[model samples]
Target: MSIKIYGDPGSGSLRRITSAAAVMGVEIERVNIDLFKGESHTPEYLELNPHGLSPVMVDGDFVLYESSAINLYLAEKAGSDLAGTTTRERYEILQWMFWSGEQWRVFATLTFDEVLAKRFMGKPADESIVNLAAAKLRAGASVLDAHLAKHDYIVGDRLTLVDFDIAGPFSQNERTKIPLNEFPNLVAWQQRLLETVPAWADTKREVDVRIDTALEAAGIKL
Candidate 1:
């Protein structure tokens, strides 16, 4: 069984998938797609992923998209501890995975596009949009912070798919200049995640370097 992952290094989805593969001790063949050049939107790529997104996974005849879904698939396939063994554990993993995708991704992407992209990448920033995105992100962070206050990991004590799913978007706070002090619990949770999952911290460093390289190549002062 061979696994191929098509994604750009700087993409959040790519970081998540790569981190999952690392944790699962799986070797993945990476096909880098140039986002700025619109390679992902090309006809052939579109045929593989109708959504034209990064981090598409092809495992033998099975093809999948969505970063979280890819991580879950890889974890299950590897029979790693990242995927819970029991039904209850699986459900708990799914719960946090959903929360990460819906809550964290939504706000992080919005704020990144509105504020960070403009400030760091030289994109135009609309004050109104930035303000709105900031408010939404803060609200979402508060939710995660509250939940994290009582739990070390997203799903009870052990690190599972829930923790993997949120790592990418959560790491964005550092680069995107989103303050974590307001969400102390979330900040603490992230630190603990980094400590427990060293691969996550490594992936974060790689992702940061990749993004900086991409921006530098584009002549954007980030």
Candidate 2:
């Protein structure tokens, strides 16, 4: 079974799906879509994904978009322990996945647009908008930090697709200077994730470099 993943480096969606595949011991043929140059908007790419989003997954005749969806699909395909073995476990995994997408992703996108896009891509930055986004982002992190304090992983004791799904956006928060120090549990959780996940550790340096460049361009000192 051949799987293809199209994404730009350092995108949270890319990290989520790729890390999921790695954890499942699945090898995906990567197709790099250059978001830096609007490659995702090209006619050919748009034909594949009308939304023009990165982290598109193509398996045989089936094609899917959205990072969370891709991660779940890979986990299901691989029967990875992360997908959960029971009905309740599956529900918990889905719950955290939804939380990550609805809550964390919204805040991260706002910051990316208000800060990184403005600074690095020469777009306009709205100070009020970013401040609001920062507030919401911190609020969400607080909740996550509280939950993580009691649990080693998002769903129960073992790592699941939930952990992989949330890690991408949460890790990006550090890059955006969201002040994770306020959430000590989250800081420790991220460190533990990096230590346990080989894929995350392998990509850490590259991810940090990319985030640093973007943050620096935005005048956000790490």
Give lDDT per model, in order. 0.78, 0.79
For every model in order, what is the number of clashing pairs?
Answer: 0, 0
Cα lDDT of model 2 by residue, 63-135, tens digit: 8998888887887788787888899998888888888788877777878767666666566778888788878
- lDDT by residue for model 1 (15-85), tens: 87787788789899998898756788999999889888787988888889998888878887787878888
Q: After aligning candidate 1 to the native by TM-score, how far in Å is the CA of 91 from where it should be? A: 1.3
Q: Which candidate is the best by TM-score?
A: 2
